[model samples]
Target: MTRSDDESRRVYATQGLIDLLLERAAAADPARENVVLDATPAGEFDADLGVDPATPVLTHFYLPAGRAVSDVFGVDLGTPAGRGRARFLTHPQGPAELTRRDDLAGVVLLAVPPWGTETLTAFDRQGRRLPLTVLDAEPPVESLPE
Candidate 1:
């Protein structure tokens, strides 16, 4: 198989893993109600090409915001319940600009609970918390694509 074909397979496998995770999360929590699985992008890159021809992909999965505030931190944010309480505050910088900037290529899985509005968390492809913030609770917007 060609290099491009291998890369495509890898990307597909990665997406499958992410899909499985979301499915498990939904099954684990029936109340999870809204589960969104954004699609990852497929592409080609050249090493000889100047500037790493990478890209940033944002896959946002919005759930309801929870209603409990915990002084406890550093918990496993990958859990369905845990991520429900987490929010993406900011990136390596402050919590100002978290939008796609360059071809860095990253995946964000956001879980906003339905009950509360002050929760937000962004997880990486490996389900690790990057940064999060808690704001005034707001109802989850039902804008996710089916």
Candidate 2:
């Protein structure tokens, strides 16, 4: 696929992600539902936990300005609801990794923080805070000692 095709394909993929998250949220039992968040954009990040590539990655974006606002979203990745929020922190993207914005920094936990809304906005400039999630975080590169 060309660059345009790739970009277009992502549009569809992102849409699908929204659908799944709504389902998960509705059926979410606070006792069981859990989401993940990276403290910082530091290094590489992860979008999908362990599901297939088709599984949509979740995201939250503020409208108008398209800046990131803390919100929670999720998917029962690679497991059943009984597992209860299996999202574990990977890299230190939160405060521990922040070179700036420490006031907004936090631990890179799998659970998304509560935003007092049902949806997580991934970039709805129109102003709909649907729990938009994404799994497009890049993984850390491994380097060997020289």
Candidate 3:
């Protein structure tokens, strides 16, 4: 298969997994409908993440609560300027607008680049950052031929 084909399949599978998780969450708690996660991009998908001053770093992370991700990014603990460059991902659909019976789960595009990300954080409805549990992916031993 072509590289584009592989990428398309990857995107489809990732979205399917997210849908399954949302379904399961809804089944467990009927009141969890229309759950707005803080891991969504607050504005345009192509918004500059400000990771680098010379170049724009764009990333949209839609991390599910209590789930392990395949990608990992380290926080810039050595640089004090990193804290000022932090960008938060918040759901576009405000929580106050959602009703108890709205089962519409927010659609998240998970096609994110792993580079230029200094820090990652998720927040609750009360604006408290929740601890994230990440599962780092093993590095590939070889690269695919172009």
Query: Candidate 2: which stretches are off by over 4 Å?
Result: 1-13, 35-118, 122-146
lDDT of 3 by residue, 57-87 (tens): 1122223332132133343223233222222
lDDT per residue for candidate 1 within 1-146, as digits (tens), equals 67564333221112333344445444544333323333322223212222123422223343423323222444323335523321222232223223453111243434333212233345554454453222122222335688
Question: What are the lDDT figures for the candidates, one per model?
Answer: 0.33, 0.30, 0.28
Measured against the true structure, the TM-scores of the candidates, in listed sequence, are 0.22, 0.22, 0.19
Q: Between candidates 2 and 3, name the one with more favorable lDDT.
A: 2
Give me the candidate number with maximum lDDT: 1
RMSD of each: 15.9, 16.0, 16.5
Q: Select the stronger candidate by lDDT from 1 and 3.
A: 1
Per-prediction backbone clash count: 18, 24, 0
**In model 2, where is the ten-residue run with the lowest total lDDT?**
84-93
What is the full ranking by lDDT, best candidate first?
A: 1, 2, 3
Error of 1 at 102 (Å): 30
Error of 3 at 115 (Å): 6.5
* TM-score: model 2 vs. ground truth: 0.22
Clashes of 2: 24
- lDDT, model 3: 0.28
Error of 2 at 143 (Å): 30
